[model samples]
Structures are given as structure tokens and as C-alpha cells.
Target: MLVQNSLSEVLRAREELFTRTIWTDPTSQLQNRVKGSELSRYFLLTESERIGIEQTIRLLVSTTPYYLSLSDPTDPNCPIRRMIVPTAEEAVFSLEESSDPLDEERLSPVRGLTHMYPNRVLLFSNHSCSVYCRHCMRGRKVSSSGERMEKADLETAFDYIRNHHEVEDVVVSGGDPLNLADARLEWILHELNQIPHVRICRLGTRNPVTLPFRITDELCKIIERYNDDNLSIFCHTQFNHPKECTKEAKDAILRLLKVGVSVGNQAVLLKGINDDEEIMLTLHKKLLEMRVRAYYLYDPELIPGSRGFRTPLARGIEIVEYMRGKIGGMGIPHFVNDLPGGGGKITIGANWYLGYYPKTRQHAFRSAVTKKIHFSFEPVGSDKESYYPVLSEADWEKFQAE
Candidate 1:
């Protein structure tokens, strides 16, 4: 009934949006600038995003006729329309995308438990986020049929994990784990802590970015109890720009750090959003400043209808390489591609080394023959050159002369 009602409202809203020509490619650009006045109040563009939206509109207006000629398409100019419309480019991308990109369901032995990697499991708790992202991998389920798992469902998942001794690490994630009520969350954490085999408890939530108000002092205290040696919190965020990193989000991250929850972020690499090296570096720096470690800079998942958002593999690699020596190692998150059909996350970043440098213990593997005896250097020849070789003395001398 709710979906039906929402769908009706969305349809009616679309008609109004299209008639105003806001759905037209060029007019859609004005969406961000329509604020406070008639156009903005109707469109729901936030103050932080308004300027960027308007700028995009201005550019589109000058460049494309296809965008300018379009009139109402039965919905307003918003992400929701972009996500649901089948004929849109996003829709085409979505059609090509898979719901279980990694084939997570095959690993789900029970209702909500996914045992993929060894000693680790992913638990689905709540399935609704405060603000749904257009490129959300779980968009297929979340707001529609795949709502939050009931307490009983969670208990069943817990039983499955308890019986399976192999599951030592548990990653509790859902639409956004933070959406659960504080009391319910605490209960879940307490139960997970009681399981001795569940050595590490990592949470995947976007609340710190979308709804920071949900993270209260009381919630931090509850988290502190489980913050011993094994427990950690992975605060997965969806920040795409410097503008998204607001002061409120920073404060939430600081509190998580203060409570000894090792905070880390996971960002989706979306096209036309944060596909640039500068944006990536800026985001990493901001996270470090907030004491949150950068974790994964994910290539947008191939969830059905999400193809439009993905950046090219080469672009992703380029971004990572640009940041490698430019910034601190701690701030550089792994650039990874979550392989289709459950192959699992694979690091796709630039390999600094063309080959492997066999690490030896006592001495450096150099041609310098000193009084050192027990160990000797082995040259694999230029054919088997592992990694970039250290600069030769002659090479260094020539460089100095230059």
C-alpha cells in the first residue's frame, strides 16, 4: 500500500515537473538554483548542492538541444526519478547491472546471513536508509520488498553463525545499520559480543554522513563496551565531494574516534561525481583530518541500472596512481573492483612494482660485496627484473652531475 501510494505521488509529481520543463536536460540544470523561491521549494534542492546543480544546468542549457526541448516526463527532477525511470540512461545502466553483483545470495545459507570469505560473515539487519543513494547496490530491495530483517530473522542468522565455528569475524551491515533504534542496536552488539568466536565486530553504516544525529553519546557508550582488542567499527560512507564533508559529519566521525571505534570509510567511485584525482585526494585528506582511516575507494558496483555511474577501470587506476606518492600512505585507500558474480573484492590499483622483489631478512640484496658472508645477492637478469631496480652508483653519479 505504501509503495502504491508513493508511486502515485511520484507519478503526479512527475507530471508537474515535466510540464514546467524541468525534466528537459537543459532546464534540469536549473534544479539547484531554484531554491527558497517557487522552483526550489518544489524541487527540494539543498543549500550545499544548489550551486553545483545550477552550474550544471547552465552548461547543459548551452550545449545540448535534446535536453532543452524535453518537457515534463511525469516526475520532478530528482534522483528518485532518475533511478526508477526505465528509458533514462541510468535506467539502461541499471538494466545491465545485476542485483547480486557478487552473487551474495548464493552464499546466503539462511535468511539474512552471507558467509563468503573464510572466518568472516556479512549480516543483513535493517534494509532502509534515511536517504537512498541513486547508485545504491541494494536499491532493488530496500524501500520495496526487501525491508528490515525482523528480530527473529536476525536471531536465526545469529544461530547460524554460532553453529558455524569458522565464522570468527562478523560484519554487520544492511541498508544502513545505523537506522536501527539505539536500544535495538545495543542489544545486537551485546549479543554479538557474548559470542566468543565472533572476534571482530565491524559495522557498515552511512549514518555518520546521512543522519549524524542518530549517533548520540549514549550510542557511543554502548559501542565503547564492545571496543576491546577485537571489535572495530567500519563507518562506510558515500561521500563524493568536498562539499559532502560537512562540519556535522566531521563531528560524528570525531565522536566515533573518541569512543575508540576505529572509523574507516568506503566511497563509491561514481562518474561525474568523484571520478577525479583531486576529489579523491581531498576526500582522503578530510577523512584523515577527522581521524577516520580511508578504507576502500570502490569502483561503482554493477547493480542493474547503475552502469551510468561507473567510472572506467583505467580512470580509477589513474586516480590511485596520482595519489600514491603524492599523499601519506595511511590516507591512500585501496582502489578495488568488486568482481561480478561473487569473485570478491580485488585490488585494481596501479602496481608500483612491475615484478616482485623477494624480501630477505639480514642484508640488502645489492651487488656491493663487503665483509658480509652468510648471505649473497642473486641477480635474476634484466629479463627477470622484479620491480624497478635501485639506482646504480653510476646512475646516481650521472644524475648528480646533471
Candidate 2:
């Protein structure tokens, strides 16, 4: 287990890695908020990567909604409290946990591109970020898959995109496309720009958060080379803890922004990590300041050994409620979960009753009209059962029985 010493130790550690000037007014206020440790300055993603951002700091927060249960705030037994601060048990649970939880190979078409969705395609390559995450959903493919996306695969994917006129958008992602050499990435971008039907090109990478150095001046220039009215880059950067956002990471993010890339962050709402309301609020605030739009704040999946990382729906809802009116609408991210059985990603957002409010239904019945209510509303709750709709329960049961 990692020891929790006084905030002084954290500050001292920060002083060692980063110069004192980095810890200016705004940073010092944040540091004072999380009194125990100087988490942001010290927790580097991987040894080779630059030290993390010096501004992020974790705090004692909760996931319980203000409308729901807020009592007994300190125990992990509570759904909202389970992962506020991860224990050593949670971090090093076991190695048997499969890394590639999605098993995306089942959805691959020809090469590199995965035509999982009808209108969209995923370009999977061997590029990776600065560090390998222990709880990475694609853990299975990163190190051992030995599957480098060859030129043939890129051509096949591009060909598929061209043939399928319905495919109006393409998301270029891999372990981390930024990890690919600048020349190779430029080649891919150049090819995609030629496809007239392809209206948008989105690049999914985490270099801005993991290995900020990858976003060099040359890389920025290549990305800018393809940036026009139609082509825009989509970054799926993850930041589980506030401390992970370092000055170097910030610099990397600015480079992409300078080049006109549409930057967005996709953070997984881990149990003991940044599951607290204060921590989440601060992180979101920082993202907006840095010009990064906060995307999905996901609930960790129950992949083989990922139980320790999973948080209940209520915990996630609690955090949302806390930040709803408190912060700007743009700062809030929709909570989501990628369901099992290769179902597409779905957002778990605050409940907006599409059919009818209970009172509305009751009043309608009183008026003597028995009519079917047909309304489609998006859900933002904790129920896993409703996460996916690709197959109905009956259909799944039928398939299983067969």
C-alpha cells in the first residue's frame, strides 16, 4: 500500500521535481485544499515520460448525490465511497485480469479499421501513450498483441471507408496514434484527406495526458496540415487523478490547440481515484481553463479483475448532481458505461423522463384516456441493465438458449 504522509511531504517532493515557480498562486490554493499529499507534482505516468502537471490535487469527496444518501460518508461499503481513495489492495489486485476487455478483434473488417458502427469506423494501430495504464480497457492488445498496423491494413481501412458511402465520419485511433512516427501519421492523414465522402477525421489519442512530449512542433504541423472546415481531430485523453495534469501535459495540450485540433477528454470515474465531488469539480474546471472539453466520465467496467475499480451508478450520479448547477453546463461531462457483449458505448446521464412523469401519467389516467406513451428519453442513472439496447433481454436469452 502507498503510504499517506502529511501534505508537507507532498510539497517537498513537488519542490524536488518541479521548480517553485510552477506552484504559483492558483496552484498553491489547490495544494492547500488537499492537505495530505502533493499528488500532482510527484505521480508520473511512466518513468520515461515528463513529470505530471503540477496543478491537479485530490481531496476527500463523495459520490453520493445531495438528494440521495449522504450519511456515513467515510466507509468504502457505500457505493459512493468505495473508491474515493484507492487502497493498495485495489491497485495490485492481480495480473490475471485480461487487458483487452473489449475483444475488438471480433469486430474487425479488413485491416486497422473496425466497422463496429454502421456509419463510423475505428482505425486501430499499434501506437501507444507514454505509460501503460493498469486499468486500461485495451490492456490485452497494447504490449503483447504484437499487431502493428501495416500499410496494407491502412489501405484496406481507407478502401472500406471510400466504398461505404454511408460512412461520413472516421475516428483514427490505436494504442495511441501519436506514438506512431510523425511521417507515418502524416501519410495516413494525407491519404484520408483525399477521400471526398469522408467528411470528418477524428484522431483518438492520449498523448496529451500520458506522454505530452509526443505532441511535438513537427507533429502539430502535420495535424494542422489536414485541418480544414471538414477535418477535425478528436482526442480521447484520460486523467483519473488531478495530479496527472502537469505543466508538460498542459504544454502538449496547447500545442494541439494552437494547431486547431478539437480537443476533448474522456476520463474514467474510478472508485478510489477522482471519485470525489471536489476532486471531480476541480478537474473539470481545469479542463475548461485549458480549453479541453470534458467528455465522458465513465464507470469502470467489470472486466475479469476490474471489480476493485468499478463504482455503483449512484456514486456517479452523486457527483453529477453536486456539479450540475454549481458549475457551467459545458464543464459537466455525461457519465457513461460501455456495456458487455460488444454493444456500443452509451451515456449514463441524469434522468430526463421522456415518457411521462409519474404525476403526469396519473393525471392523464384521471382524464379517462388510455393511450400508449411513446417517448424516447436518454437515461443517466446507475442501472447496468439499461446501458445497451443493441439486443433486447428476450433476444439475448433466446440466443443463449440456442
Candidate 3:
């Protein structure tokens, strides 16, 4: 486990690195690096090659000084670079792509909310991030160029939650929740906490990785203030590669953990990034070291202009099966496919059949509605019959005679 110590020195280091970040422009990012103008020194890209990438993709670069410092400018295939840096390959568009592959726009009841599951609502509070990842599922819609939730919109969202008492959980997401000011974030959380039925609130962000300073002392206090006995607040972030587990990132996560807030990870299974099993195992193990649960290994969605990041489904199954029995299940995340056409996320695993038996209807824990893992929902609950075909004595005798 990563124990928190006197971080005065660590904080200073992170702060120094934080100051070196380049945002808004790719050209600025290149200039801030050791050798930015001389692109041929690092990447073998022509002037036109660079222009093509910038023109085709709605490029929004927000790479932090801390994250950029951990790169090898020599190796073109560096996983870290593959994540944030856009390339000419992005221009190679695919006909099978879409503006919203998961069809989130269709299910959205309000402007900022996507109500997919019955009891949970995904609330997009902001439309910006610390770094603009190249493989973002909502790259087209949330390009950071769009406006955030207005005051009236926030009130409307609260009203939506108040009216729908069924929404027990709300996931605050967008570009990243941390991108919003502390006051704005607090307002959102405070409103959600007021609802009697809202049990869990999760914020999906990438701030801690790209911008560690976002999880400040004040933010931690805000998280603590709202986390009461009735309502729980958790922060879920993404870490695709092990290189992202920097000292600064760990410190940021530790701050959240020390507070009443729980932290979890949602790693994207991207090609040329964390596609290998061992590479993933290390990344997840390191997450547990920082006290973050490895929650979901998501199958890259069929989004427009993201064909380059797609990996085979069979590889995902292979990794799951490899980890199921061989390794301890401490930090193993569920491999899931965010089913096309707004089907929602479905957990994928190795074939669960034992030659004669059919595919499992239950999850690893034997819940009939495996999707609702924690909830004691229907058929699988104790209210249901323990054993079916409870034959009477007469019926048993008649069957034997027959």
C-alpha cells in the first residue's frame, strides 16, 4: 500500500511540474518540450503531416507538466504519448464510426444528464478537462469547446433528481468534474446530498492524473463536508497505462482517500496502450497500492475517428480468463462492453460453460440480476424460493412409477 508521509517535498515537486503544463495548442505543447520546433528530432512527421492532424480532429491538448515529464521523446510508440498526443492517423476516418456511438444523446432526458440505468443517472456538469485524451468516447460532443451546465440547467437537474426518486445514484461526469470551480462542484454535491433517496454520488474525472493540484485541501474538505452517514461520495478516475501512476498522481489520490472520499479506477482497454495482460495487471496492482479499486476495464466504444484505438473482443476475454484463476482477485476489474445502440455496459468474460452447463445467468457472486451487483433486487434475493420443483410425496411416488 502507498502510505502517505510528510508530502511537503512531494507537493513542491508536483507544483514545479504542474507549472510546466502546456494547454490549448499542440504547437505550444511541442514548444514547451525539450525540443518542440524540431519535430524531426522526436517524431518523423512533415509540416503537412502535423497540419493534417490539427485540421481533421478537433484537437484540444491539456497535457500537464508532470505527465509530459514522464515521456521518452525518442520512442515514437510511447504509451504515454499515444494517450494524449494526436497523430496523423486520426485523419484516417472510418465509415463505421459515429458522433455518439453509445447513443447517449438519444437517452438524455435533460441537456446535461444521460439516464441509462433505472436507478442511476449520469450528470454531465462540465465540458472541460485537465488533458484532452485522444481516445475519449465523447470526443465529438465534449470537445471542451462546448459550454458547461448553466445555473438554470443545474436547478433543472436537481428538479429531475427530486422528481425521479428512483435515482439512488448519480455519476457526475463530463470532460471532468474537477474542471469546475470548487464552489460549483460543492453546489452540485450539496444539492444531490439534499435528496433523501440519493445514496451514492460518483464523480468521473481525470484531474488527479493530469492536474494533481485540483484535489486540493479545500476540495478534500468539500468532499468531507458533504459525505454524511446517509450519502456517500466517491471519485472515479481513469489510468490506462502504468506510466500514469506518478508520485504526484498517487499523492492526489491519497488526499482523497485520507478524506471520507473513496477512489476507484475505470481503465480504457486501448490498443497500443494497456492491451497486454501483464501490462494491465501491473497498472491495476499499482492502483490498489494507492488504495484505488480497479473497477472497470471498458471495451473501447465504436466512436467516430477512434478506429485506431480499437482492440479485439477476444483479447479482452483472454485477459479476463487469465486473471480469473491464475492470479488473486484483489485488484481485478470487470471487463465490460458498453454495448452499442445504448444497450448500456455489459460485463464480458471467458465462456462460463462446463461442457454440459449453459452460459451463466449469475455473476461471479451468483446474483440473478448480475448487472445490479450490490442491490438485493428481485429473483436473486432471499424472498425467492431456495430450490425449485418442491415435489409432494404423492407426486414423487407417481413419477417413480411412471
Please give the distance, in angstroms, between residue 143's alpha carbon in candidate 2 and its true position after superposition: 1.6
Worst 10 residues of 3 by lDDT: 354-363
Instruction: Work out candidate 2's RMSD over C-alphas.
Output: 12.5
| lDDT digits (tens) for residues 282-334 of candidate 1 | 98888788777778888888776555567788988888888876678888888
The candidate that wins on TM-score is 3
**Local distance difference test, per candidate?**
0.62, 0.58, 0.71
The order of the candidates by lDDT, greatest first, is: 3, 1, 2
Candidate 1: C-alpha RMSD to true structure equals 11.4
Writing each residue's lDDT as its tens digit, candidate 2 over 83-170 gives: 2222333333344544444546777777566777888888876644334444556654554446677888788788888899888778
Candidate order by decreasing TM-score: 3, 1, 2
RMSD of each: 11.4, 12.5, 10.2
lDDT of 2: 0.58
What TM-score goes with each of the models? 0.70, 0.66, 0.78
Q: Which 10 successive residues of model 1 have the least lDDT summed?
A: 57-66
lDDT tens per residue, model 3, 1-402: 112223354445445543654443323433343222222333344443365345446445446554565655445478886765566666766788776878888998888888999999999887776666778888765655565678798789889999999999999998788878789989998999999999999989987776776677888899899998768999989988888898878989999988878888898998888899899888887888888887899998877567668999988887766566544576888999998899988898765431211122221222222321221222434333433323355544443354
